[model samples]
Target: MEITDLTPAELRVWRAFPLNEGVDLRESADDDPADGASWGPGRTVRAEVLRALLLDGPTTGGRVPGLKLTGARVTGRLDLMYGTVDPAMRLRSCHFEKPPNLYGAQVRALVLSDSVLPGLTAGTLRVGIVLRMTGCRVTGPVRLAGAQLSGALFLDGAVLGVPGARSGRPPGPEREDSGERPEPALQLNHATVGTDVWAVGLTAHGRVRMDGATVGGLVNLDDAELHDPDGLALEAETLSVGTDLRAARLRARGMVNLSGATIPRRLVLSSARLSTPAGQALRASVSTIGELWLRGTAPVQGAVNLRGAQLDLLEAAPEVWPERVRIDGLTYRRLSPHLPAERRLPLLEREETGHLPYAYEQLATAYRAAGDEVGARTVQLAKLRRHRRTLPPYARLWGYVQDVTVGYGFRPMRAAGWLLVLLLTGTLAFARERPRPLKADEAPDFNPVFYTLDLLLPIIGFGQEAAFAPRGVHQWLAYLLIVTGWILATTTAAGVTRALSRQ
Candidate 1:
């Protein structure tokens, strides 16, 4: 473990030992081969001496390493386990043969930018400031389970998950498909981050688990490629984010489960390609988020399961959405792309017929909020019909009757139409077979049209029917007309009451 970067006093103290010790020495990068070269032999700082420098402070003859090294080659495992130390340690472009163990350790700020590690196990580690791993590559799993970070955790351009893995080309203008196999990956379960978790251009070969994690800021995974088709590529169950979880152009080969997660802001997943045909591609069940923006360049490949999720806004065209998506109880306050009900209803066009009542309620609620009463009523009625479809034959028949007569109390005009037809039938019947007046003197002023009108008003009456003398079939015909009128009047009254109540 040769510590290449060191100070004058630090070098004197370490000069007594061999160069096999991995030491922490923070200094400037003046030994650049590109700068016409300047060098002594590479320096070595041992772990024991390094700990003394950090924990015990500097000395006159002896010294503590500043723990900042640039372009240093580390030989052995840089173990910092069970040590609660506060020092800004920045290791840049360093190559480590053995993985660093920072378990149960505490740090102020740590940087491992532009480095390559075999693997990193930092479980229960506490970082006060930023824990940056920018442009680094880890061949083995980079486990950060139960870790606590007061600042941000960046993995910009980091390639993690499997050992010796490499990412392919950037996604082109064509569809970015997750059409290949995946490898194993990383876990950050129950980790608490005060700031954001930047993962831009991250290539994780295996699954990434962030279950029960809480992020104070955004978790940006833009242009990330997580490939694990046989299982979940990203599992973020019950995770909480203060800001957005932006994953624009994220390509995942397997499922991305965000079930029961809480995002105070929006979830920007535009241009994301996730495929899990065996089950769901994305699961956000019972999650709470603000806006959900799925409006991207191309349609998503697999189904999105949003069962019982609550969101403020939904930004996506219904027509372009895939048919396999499930959205039961997926509540949203507004629909984006701002189309009218007539046009917006088409977003539900690709939805399945067996959707739950809560699913229709979500749609109806959106319509109602937009002041589209007709659209709301339609959705509600459709919901009832769909419910009826799951019932037995007799119940279905009853539902059909209600639909044709009163639109299940949604279409009052249909009931009125039936009433008109009934009245006309009665009028024609009375005109053809004129009932003679019971007495000869009552025969003179008979008008059949007025007679039909008087008979149809079941709760009201005119004197015309009394003036007529009907016997045999004509009397029976009067009975039939009265019964038909009763049915129409009853159904019409019920329908009107329902419509008023809905309004």
Candidate 2:
């Protein structure tokens, strides 16, 4: 073929060449002496044919190599829609100043790595293939919305600069149908990434939304920084990562909502600081996690909400949590009544010793429940005593004492002594009121008091009634005295005999 300026029609014919039949377009180009520009030294003839090659054919064993398009500036969008490359297509160090659209382009083997795509000013750029951009820098925001990736999407050490600059034409705008209002950066949604995905050390000026993304392996965002107010460092919902989701030192101003997500392995968010509201910090709601390990000294100004989350422990072993787990203001109001008496008692005692009056009040209520009125009264008295001691100086004017007089037995000793006196007085009155009866043979003229004394004198002299009688009574008295003298002697003898026997 002669060296000539190829048109779009001629370029299409070159792309339609059969796989087996080879068409070599290498030719020596004569120098344009008038323009003073060399042509054949580093000129690539196959570069012109690449813009027209519709990749609508099968990529069973296809191969394209030695096709250099270094610093190729495409004015309009270059669409490689539904293109298939079976073998490796080498685009080493190729630069795309304009946006090179590769939407739904399937590649069976390796795509070129380390390709630079800067200032890609196109809306809704999608790469639905095994696209690998290892160490590639995207100067502007690039959207890969709804892109299904089978292989790994490695963007390690890629610098994603802010969108607008001094240039009138800025980067591509985000997708409008993505439900996210106009932001100044890239967004990846519903992107199924197979194998390990690494975007470590990738900087994003604006929000980098990856909602509903699923990664097969570990998704690492080791040391990524975001410098915007509404800048979301990561907003992945239902993000399914296989192993670990290590995101250390990830700073975000807005909320990092990983709500309703399932992390099979450990989800480490160590040393990540957020300076937003309590509602906009780290949120993980209703998430099922194996172990959500958080280490390092990460200061969270906002709340770390993990409500309704279930933590599962598979193995039959003890799990330790050394960190201070505080559940402050966690309301379990329905469970308060159902708490056991033994458990509630300790809490009540803790409150009591802490000088909480409510604890003693509740203890009185508990005693009432147990039908212990005395115990309740005792506790109430103790509370009153404590209140008196803690009163202010001005309130201490009324020096009232609660007289707690305790007696060993039932009544006071003075009351018991009065009862005994009443009993003795009643007995004496009954004895004086009763009439004394005279004996059948005794005279009625006899003085009752003198007769009683005379009867007592004879008994004192050992039953000598004859000695105390008158003349015929006096003669009887003399007889009585003689008999009394003899009886006294006999009685004295018997008393001595009884005393000796008792000994």
Candidate 3:
């Protein structure tokens, strides 16, 4: 770090560092080092020079020192591993020959916006303030595992990893089979950010790992395109966010897993296009979210798994529902749009796995809590109908009878209506032809109403059934009445018992 080794461009940046003034070395705004790397020594600053300027004190008489350089080409690695840098560093519109090795370094603030670098290796780095990398193009992986940031992490408009030639997609199958396991484009595993992580308009070619990361504020991924066709596009399992995770218009080529996460506020995935054909597109199983908004126009291409999730409110549109869903243990207190049970029942029916009774039960509970007893019954009826499909032939036939007779015990009034119709028919039929007495001396008077009542009520004998005996069709009519009476009594008792047991 001798003074004689400073190039003209480096000397200019060094002199400007004392006054905290940013030195712009570009001749024009279009003078990009990413195009052909033709920047001469006049705009090229060695990484060692910049590193020394950040760590060392200012030269002669000067103001408070800070390294603020723009539109310069940084050559060689800015190896600041395990170093403590107090000044704020801003290297906007710059190009780096190699990734800055800041592993285990503690910095005040770092801004590399609109910069082009091979990559960054800042694992376990500590930042006192914000780390802004907006509008940068990073070719290699940006590993920030276990890093702790006291402020927000701004990555909006940044392009990370080697993006595909076609619309920033991931590498093709041939490139994937090159026998090398690709690293994540943006790795924040186990990182703790005090504030938000704004990643809007980000295009990441590989996986974005934020597993076990804790964000104090919201994490906005709006308009972000993540591509990892061979694996997960974004894996944030067990991620704990204090506020919301807004990802509207996000296009992920692989699975977006948030399993075991806890988002206290909202998790908005509106208009997100997630595709992992024949696999799960979104898995937020066992998570706890306050409000989950899936209401949007885009169609999810794969199954959505919310098994064991607990949500305060689930807001989803009909068009956004995928073909297959796993809601085994999902429990939501409310469903959005205030739709009726009939309309929302289709969501519970979309489970391709075995019939989940818990989902139906949860929906019914939600409806009942909203003071919609009829809607709750409808959901319960639908649950029985779905369960009936899994029964044997005879059981299914019996299920149909139960459904028609009493709505599987959810409609007690239907049983009453059937009883009334049967009672009236019996009264009319027997009154037309009275039966002869079985024993003339002991027989009671022939009373059609009492005789029909005796036939209908199995346990109650009105003494008229014993006294009467009908001939020919009259006998057949009596037999029909007797069987009808018993069947109605049995069904009514069963339905009533079921209804009471549920309560």
Candidate 4:
């Protein structure tokens, strides 16, 4: 390749290489690299040549402190560890010979759009503005541990891969011998982004970790493809996102762990796909979010654990719910309008050992607040029945009695209905053959209705039974009436007490 064959854009970078000043590669004011940025292989920029230029102080003339080496093929690793580069590095549409080592480097804004690198070791890298990378390809892992970005960390439409990609490696990509989980394809462990961490249309072939990272804006991964098969694909534990954590249309191969994450806004996973056979597909245990929407999304093969999560609402279809999602401690105020308690209660029936009673209690409370007392009682009854299975034999029997008699104290009217049936049966049975008067001087005749009432009402007894004792079949009938009264009275009291306490 000769210099004369270089394009205008290539020639500009060649001419500006010696100045060490940050160069803007945009040829025209209306130019867009995302559309496509063309590059030529006419010249190759060595690592030492660029390093010398970057290490030197500013010239006597007024010049920007940043370094820009766009549209050039560089040979050798760019090591800027512990070095202070006064200006931003906008290396767009460039190819690196080796990974750039910027461990603990300080710079202004950092942009590496439309470039190719072997890997990146940017641990503790501090950027004043943004650390943005878009439309780039990296063969190895990209680490950003302890990094602090004043602006967003954009890796949109980038293709990231893991070098060795062993079955079960340790964290941070450096420990391949430990045999733990593989390091994230794009690691941001404890990195704080002032704005967003936009990776829309990203294709990563390893774990994506943002543990303890704080994003002031959204963490959008819409249409992103991530895979780690036997391990976690996305681990954002303890992450704090100020706005939405949108991952619509995301296709993740393994578990997506967001345990203890805090998102003040919503977590939109509409149409997203996540699958993990070994364990939970999505673990948001103890995470706090405004809302979670999984509308029309792909079903997860494994459990989606949301234990201890606090959210404003949950939007998910019943049929599309995961096989075993643990919502034991999920504190959500509302379900989607399409998913009333009648439809959504089944999803809470996860946790193979049986769901926690509080889970059902919370859902019933939500239904109750929505002016659906019947629905609330329905959920409450289910909770009681499910919880009964976990109790001792005696308690379970009691729960059964309560359920059949008064719907576990939810149907006090059932108890009253039984009382009315007993009263009617006794009155009608005794009316056929009234008890004969034992005393001839008895002034009042035996009233069948009053006599039946006296036998049925256990709280009060009348002298009718003592005055005229029944014979044979009638004697047995009287015994039956007395037992019926006792059963009704006891159950009615229990039901009334339960109802009053519920209120």
TM-score leader: 3
Specify the highest-lDDT model's number: 3
Task: In candidate 4, list every pair of residues with a backbone clash.
Answer: 66-87, 184-207
Model 2 lDDT tens row, 214-250: 7888878777665444534467777777787777776
Candidate 1 per-residue lDDT over residues 1-503, each given as its tens digit: 24445555346444522222334333465432112112232533334444554554443334434456555555567788778765567767666666787877898877888777777778789999899999887777677889999999999899885633532311221111366633236668899999999999999887788999999999999999988746588989999999899998888888999999999888888887777767778889899999888777356567778878999998877554656767766788987776655665444544554546677778888888888778888887877777787889997986777787788888878867887886777778778888888777755577777787777777776788878866678778788777767766776777678667866
**Candidate 2 Cα errors over 4 Å, as ranges:** 1-48, 53-76, 85-87, 90-92, 109-114, 118-129, 163-174, 178-180, 277-279, 312-503
- List TM-score per model, in order: 0.79, 0.49, 0.91, 0.86
Best-first order by TM-score = 3, 4, 1, 2
**In order, what lDDT does every prediction score?**
0.73, 0.47, 0.86, 0.77
Q: What's the best-to-worst order under lDDT?
A: 3, 4, 1, 2
RMSD of each: 7.6, 25.8, 3.8, 4.5
Clashing pairs in 3: none
Give candidate 3 misplaced runs (Cα > 4 Å).
59-62, 165-180, 390-397, 437-450, 459-463
Q: What's model 4's TM-score? A: 0.86
* Better candidate number, 2 or 3, judged by TM-score: 3
Query: What digit string (tens of lDDT, one per residue) describes model 4 on residues 2-42?
Result: 55654554455545644654445444544443333232334
Poorly placed runs, candidate 1 (over 4 Å): 1-65, 163-184, 297-300, 320-329, 338-355, 421-435, 469-484, 500-503
